[model samples]
Target: MGRMKSSNRKKIIGALGDPRIKPYLEASGGNEKDALALYRWSVELTASIQETLGVTEVLLRNSIDVQLRKWNNEQLGHSASWLLESPASPLRSMTKSKRKEALRRAEKSATCRSASHFRHGQAVTHDDVLAHTMFGMWKDILPNHSPGADPEKTENKNRMTLWEDAVKNAFPCAEDPEGEKTYWRVAHLHELRNRVSHMDSLLNVDVLDVTRDAFALVGSIDPVLANWLTGTSTVSAVYGKRPE
Candidate 1:
């Protein structure tokens, strides 16, 4: 067998960090070349996962955004500020403190870009509102009303207002039943999204499961979107190439 290069082995160790890459190296019987190969494979797999995840996030966010806008308009008219602050709106069901926090976040997100455009003497469009607002903020405003239930229910008479209504309209399916399951899945994906955005290592994660979950979430929203993502995805191909 060819000897492993010291410089290449050192580079792999440094790039992936000790705790993560150490076990693989030990399992390879100190075969630096084999360990380095594993490291490279992991990097490639992570990249593929990140790429697929980005597409899934965009689709999920857009689906939710469209539904929210439709529901809000139907329920309380189309005033953006009223949607965020009206006593009859979803934000009303939240505790006073949570409502305040949510409003602050919504206002901050809504204005940040428009403020920039105003300063630059540029026209800001309605698209800017959609672009600047984040998926996490939407998740935050729609808290789980029935925290304890069989499959977890989004319908609660006590909390019947805009939040529950919006969830019903947004998810509205047998796959997620009450929408709690969908909410939970999106929450999990959001956490994973954060890690990927921050450039954190996903070596310890089950990349296949993450990929499956992402596709499933998109599938739940729109099967056609999921199919499109699957056709373009490199996750499965990259995962197949992992070192044995």
Candidate 2:
């Protein structure tokens, strides 16, 4: 493509907001045209990361869901969905509200999409509710440190017990206790996912390192998925093309 004229660069910068474009400008040594080029590269890099993040999110959620299902069913002594409200369930005190909210949204959507006008019945399924849950919901459920909480605190005990009974098994390859390594890696990618969704700058982000963490997180659940993600990811290629 031809060089972006200065007027066009100014227009682009104005539309994108100076704050958002400032990092690119600095990276390009204050050259407006170069800054625009870097901005375009950032867009491409964000797209690449978003694509991989999509796959990673699904893999992580589904893997964790599977274990939760098994554990929940075992606790209930029957095959039952794990996401429903259960006073005896670990989610009762922790993620119950989130799950309820997500399911409510899913049902609301189903009502809109359905042919029925009555509010009595909707076709929303467990999978629909699961699909509507945010990435943070999955991340928050993982075992994590609570700095000042007593070991017997409800949150602490729930997280530890959940990890032992279910979450850790989600990652067949994770070797760390309580899936600490897996949790942090998922947290890393979750942050990246948020940045991409919010249209934030990737200028200071270690894109390659983040992508590696993404691949490793998927691999932790299943090496086959990791291989697939690595083979298909284009973030590395896009990163290499960043403007000088």
Candidate 3:
């Protein structure tokens, strides 16, 4: 082993902006060799997480979309973007200002549908609606009245209520009897996905746990899909190679 080139060394140090990596390098007394090793491990771990998260994100979005569509068609008789504004949606329970803001964000996302045409060479389908929308927008509609609130009050009142109604209704089924647990899990995974998508450091995160929770959510939605995802995932192999 020869010494690393000056330019390569500088690049390695510059990439170590993640705060979690600093302490390890400091513990190594600023040794360049150790710093490079730690940096490589960080890069490898981030790559592994990004790969696994890509699969999980798609699975989650698809699962939620499928269930939402089923519920909307069954209850509302139609399942288009207009369903967001339907009386049956939890969005109807938000305060006037909050409801406006949520709709505004959702509209902005809808506008971005043209970008999909440029990329995929096809018009955006109904299934692509959630893909266009941001996770924050979805989470915003979760704070409405409880599952069985009075329809009258739901229209104008914005009282503190059990926030799990959105999740329960969105994924209505016998699989998840209490949707609160699934809601929290999916919410946390959404936050993690945001961080990874923005190229932020995840050195402190338990990537394995996040992956497992994502798979569990998938299973809750569709056991066959979950098993297929598990068979195709490389996350376990990646975790096995973590720095010792």
Candidate 4:
């Protein structure tokens, strides 16, 4: 019994020791019957501490600001962002058939997702699906430049695609060792955001995996992302926002 107790403590500390806390931490002193509660406490406490420390913004924001050079200087992910955004990539200038196919898949995803919310009186529309899809594809370009030429400036970028706008409003950039993709800032996040916004909705594992991969893509472009995530840097330092 004593050996078992020691082993458990090791597990708890190990779980808590990582810069990213696991699903559970500091709940019931590790003896609670509710693992979910522990997980919730861990996430909540960490989020709280992050904001309280002011270290959260520093790491997430500054890191991305610093790595902006990598996107243009070093080709990250075979320049995946560039490739995807290029007129050559399927996203920017695919054949009509291919574009339709992508849209079809995205539509299905939106429909299925919205239907899941229908019991609560929510409705899905084609426009919603299209907006969600487009957002997922072009979300990374709002901060410094305005695209200068929004083909349809008459169309509201915000209301027309609120889902995309929200993510852009929140995660404007991905600070990492690799420079910013800049291309994907607002778009891809729209896909993930549309599934669940302004709530504590649990995502399906597959969708969770996809979002994680997207996060990974951001990291691949910058080596310093992990450090920034852990509060080692901030946008001020990244943008050279320090006093001389």
Candidate 5:
């Protein structure tokens, strides 16, 4: 809680490496103390953003999962989870690999935890794999838009069909007929999540804008949840504490 000593700051800067501290040091106009303070502030800000993103990720995943499950069952009958579908149907080549990887990791985790539902000799459940999936998996699974992309391509057509059949329902409050807006918003948050996960610099990032985007995305699915998330978020408070 006390101001860090100059010697202690020096040690921290050295440990953090010159490259890592360079942007902060520059922003502080060569003042090592101010730079170090900014670095600490950034760490706190990152933590706050991570916390908010955690909630958003879970909400996004669950909302999409519910729709996907319903759509999968409608298409393939009872007890059919889209996540368990083979390469021939939805999920296709693009996502099948990622799904397999996530499921493999989930199974290993369940085995390690000796999960109650994960019988030693039995296969892992959909919930287990879903819980283990990364944020990017959800983002990438959504339809994409490119100016030059051919609408007739198998992948593009499949993405559109999936959106029409299932993904669009994930956002009950949003109006994204073609899924473009949703994809762009999710993509922005996905990049921010990656930066935070990698412990990269946020000194130049418009973190407030990122927060707004996050809330907006959440609001699209459920305004009540968005209100709750925004009301409880610490991003604004952390942002206010930034070193001048």
Candidate 6:
């Protein structure tokens, strides 16, 4: 056995048995040498292309994101990242500016509409968006709710509380522990929006983290988004599926 393994040519010939080579050979009607050569070319192409471009270019290679349950290659997954909501896509635009214009009329007419009707899941007056926004704001405020509440005595309020009308109007009282949790979440999102409005910085890593958690909050979290993000969901995903 040791003598058989000593030849370099024998070792190269041995590679013909690699599991990955069979499919390509079957698909292309070739022998082990042909399949192996093709594999080497694919490897070179992938590495060369990545070096020619940047890492950012490859970020979208993954298509089978389990989370959003859609091909990520088709659309970016919803992670608490800075998404600019398109007013025309039949899905919620991550864009705040766009959502605002769509929700303007809804302050008076509280009706929820389907994503297909709008430019994207955004309409001028969407009750669902409004309600979600309201919830999000209160959640953000939960961190510092109990600063000074005795209005009769006119106690000094926390500096954070006086930041804006949105802080004053949308946040829930520090007292509602159970309900406040939910409200604070909404408020934190509003705060993030505020940060964006102020021309602050955003992080994609942080965005992915936020997306994971927010997905849970919205019941849309997918552990598979990473695979999709990595482009591992192509043909392999079908094989990954269990027998029906």
lDDT of each: 0.62, 0.83, 0.57, 0.36, 0.85, 0.33
Q: What clash count goes with each model?
A: 0, 0, 0, 24, 0, 36
Error of 3 at 60 (Å): 2.4
**Which pairs clash inside model 5?**
none
> Candidate 6 residues 1-244, lDDT tens each?
3433335533664664555455555644655445445555444433322232222212211110121123222344443311223322322322245446434545334344545645444433223443323223223222344345352431122223222212222222223323334334334444543443433323111433333233232321123433343352122232223121
Taking all chains together, the TM-score of candidate 5 against the true structure is: 0.90
How do all the candidates rank in terms of lDDT, highest first? 5, 2, 1, 3, 4, 6
RMSD of candidates 1 onward, in order: 5.4, 3.0, 6.0, 16.9, 2.5, 18.9
Q: Count clashing residue pairs in model 2.
A: 0
Per-model TM-score, in order, reads 0.68, 0.90, 0.65, 0.24, 0.90, 0.24
Candidate 4 Cα RMSD (Å): 16.9
Among the numbered candidates, top lDDT falls to 5
Runs off by more than 4 Å, candidate 2: 1-3, 114-122, 146-152
TM-score of model 1 relative to the true fold? 0.68
lDDT by residue for model 1 over 1-244, one digit each (tens)?
6776798668758887887777668767877778778767867776777789778767765766666566656666554532344444444454345435545664565455554564443333344444545556555544453356322334343233444566545554326544566667667777777766665556567767777777777887778877898899898898788777
The 10 consecutive residues of candidate 6 with the worst lDDT sum are 56-65
The local lDDT score (0 to 100) that residue 234 gets in candidate 4 is 31
Worst 10 residues of 2 by lDDT: 113-122
lDDT of 5 by residue, 71-182 (tens): 7677666757666555336665657878888788987876776545446656778887888888888777677774687878888788888888888999989988999888
Model 5 per-residue lDDT at 175: 86
Model 2, position 39, has a per-residue lDDT of: 88
Point out where model 1 deviates above 4 Å: 1-4, 23-30, 74-76, 81-88, 92-126, 141-163, 198-201
